[model samples]
Target: MTLTLHLDAAGWREHLQSVRNDVPGLVPVAKGNGYGFGLARLAAETSALGVDTLAVGTSLEVDQVRAGGWDGDIVVLTPWSRHDPVATALLGDPQVITTVSRVDDLTTILELNPQARLLAELLTSMKRHGLGRADLPALRSLAPVARFEGWTIHLPMRSPDPLAEARELATAAQAAVEAPVWLSHLPLDDYATLRSELNVEARLRMGTALWLGAPKTRRTTARVLDLHPVRRGERVGYWQRRASRDGWVVVVSGGTANGVALSAPTSAASLKQRAVALATGALDASGHALSPYTIAGRKRSFVEPPHMQSSLVFLPGAAGVAIGDEVPVELRLTTATVDQVVDE
Candidate 1:
């Protein structure tokens, strides 16, 4: 039994090239399960793209990128910390560009490596990390001692006017230090506009939009391991809950270990969406949760919470599916850990 991701290799490559063409100076981001393709695979793809730089989430990923055949510059998205041994150890590597957010971190980094290459991140609307706008001028003093490759601003994914904010921050950053501007989450048109409007260079660091942009190019499937006929009120699963209707208890590959039935916090913005979320939660609380597996073109309900390597799906009598069949699975790609990836 296997949970597999199938790829339309030709279509995926075409989409990747299209994004690269649209976004000039694109720094492809390969981090955090590598957007479901895995970090090593993404690093290899990044090498194929021939970009000068690749951005990973942490210094710990640098070795994986190197092992995957990426021999270019690597920029760690997480800000440098004096306490992180991996980050500190990478200080001497000229090809690794460390992101410095706080003024004190910059001081600490410089104290350790006098000529460490750095990317200064200014505080954006996201406010997750970065040095405050008031601290921008402080980078000027440290610029001489260290190599300031660029200034970065991580804008929010949903913004009314990302271009305006990016332009403002990029302007401020350029004023403080004469270096290229690196941006995240800015729209394509806005990035182009900002790049043209700004004095120094501007580069877009893209993750989801770069790798998983074309949904049609990939498919996920799980193999049916076993099936058992069930009648109404029949006990099933580990909880031995009574079956509500006549159906087949279908065991399929993919479970909690592979991120099946695991959900990220919902970003329910509207009242209707929030109400739907609440109703879904109510159903889950009642042990009537919908499974991601689709059998005979219909989504099935879970017999119980997923086990480590497989799930029990309640397939009603209306659907016809047998063991050993490959069924489609709808899941958030970023969270899924599949057994294999096949090029179709």
Candidate 2:
């Protein structure tokens, strides 16, 4: 048995249809481990959704999407440069669209392939990528030679009011290129308002909200492979850390290799959330930590850091679990990869 992801097909289908209906021109984003469903799997789902376009993060992922028999148009979100030969080659594909954040990249793309289809990305408050408002004139100059698909606004995860921000950026994007605007992380309720206020054709590029918007539709679990009775103060795991109490040491499938026991900086907004993050950071400073594995309806502490392919979980002596029993696990989908994904 291995770490597995289970999908409630009927519920998932209902949610998918609901989103598809809500967002008339929804672009399903299938990148970054395909939100832990794999790239090819999401591509097939995108096709089933009957959308004409799909967005990916990198050029290498374009091939994987195509391999999934997705013949629809593909737009790579990451800006491309001469430094990326693979991405350039991928741009030669008729169906592949590129996003140009810098003026020079646009020049390079046009010089190499004047027929290239492109999107001019306007720098949002995110500041991660895209051309600034000042770069709009230069983008307009290069607009003639390049086949301009639209403009894009990559919004931040938590914006005070994304609709207001999008409304503000709409003017800059429209001035730069007289074309439609594509955005990410925009809420469904504000779609109509964004279009009416901005007076532009806005397309929503979604990944997490599309795949994981409804948490009740999916479940992830790891199987118990072995169990060992441990005594208090007995050293365990690779670090040889002593157990605080007598408990059953449980080995469960899923570890660092599968993106278990891995973490990212917290995006907490509230003061209480920040305090919890600080506490979590303090615990991480020490060798002791908690694992994602849930045993007996409670998350168990790790004996040590996870191994490459499995983790050691500590369950109290009174707790009971047989080998091969599947336990629930909460994982970050973007960072996670599983051996199997079962549609139940």
Candidate 3:
């Protein structure tokens, strides 16, 4: 038994079609654990959607998508460099496109593969990577040898009115390099609005909102492998913390290695959201953390921190569960690794 992500295949297919139909020039982003469905699975789904281009996080993932039989163009979102020589060599493939954030990187890419398809990333408010608006003019020189596919921008969620900011960035990007702009974090309405507002074509590079768009169609769960009755003050789990009351200690099939007890930095901006985040942090520090796994439709407390491949959950005696039973788990798909993915 293991932590598994079960997908409602029929409903998921419908959602995929609905998204494809809604968003035009959609570049399905299948990157970073493939949004918990794995890269190969997303690649196959992209092919099924008749998409011409798929965006992956790193150059190394290009081959994985190709291996999935997606002959379409694969765009690597991360910038290329000498660090990954093998991936750099893979840039030579006509079907692969690399994102060039710096002028120097553009030079390196050209030197490595003169025919490399390139997407010039514009440095937005994110400030993570990308060339500045002023630097875009310099990229015009490489438009000849290196195939200038388009410009890419990553807008931060905290940006005030993302649509307005996106329009401004799109306008600036066009002045430097007049090409289609590949962007992320735009709602369907905003995407359409931006397209109408600007003369350039816009391609939405989406991951979470695409594959995991409809939460109802995706079900993640961990199987209950073993159970042990425990009394108050009885120690359990790796830390051997004493249970507060009489209950059963559950050995579930997911743990830290599977993304349990792991947390990514929150992007919460509102007052209530920030309050919740702070409270969650406090709860986590107390050694009485809330688990993703739920029993009797109520989230249970973890006996202690998750182990490498398993977690110890404390279920109340009243909420009974047998071995080999499955419990619902709400997890961040981006950070999770499911032992099995049942598509049915």
Please identify model 2 stretches exceeding 4 Å from their true place: none
**Candidate 1: tens digits of C-alpha lDDT, residues 1-344:** 79999999889989998898788989999988878889999999888877899999999999998999999999999999888999999989989999999999999988899878899998888889998878977888888788889898999977789988988888787788889999999999888988888778888999999899999999999999998999999999999999999988999999988999888789888899999999999999998999999998888899999999999999888548877999999978888889899999
Q: Which 10-residue window in model 1 sums to the lowest lDDT?
A: 315-324
Q: Which residue pairs in candidate 2 have backbone atoms (N, alpha carbon, C) closer than 3 angstroms, thus clashing?
A: none
> What would the TM-scores of all predictions be?
0.98, 0.96, 0.95
Q: Write model 2 residue lDDT over 300-327, tens digit each, in one string.
A: 8888888999999989877588899999
Candidate 1 is scored at a TM of: 0.98
| lDDT tens digits by residue: candidate 3, 4-70 | 8888999999999999999998999988898899889999999999989999988778878878778
Candidate 2 — number of clashing residue pairs?
A: 0
Return the top candidate by TM-score: 1
Of 1 and 3, which scores higher on lDDT? 1
lDDT of each: 0.90, 0.87, 0.86
Could you report the Cα RMSD, in angstroms, for every candidate shown? 1.1, 1.3, 1.7
What C-alpha lDDT, on a 0 to 100 scale, does residue 196 get in candidate 1?
88
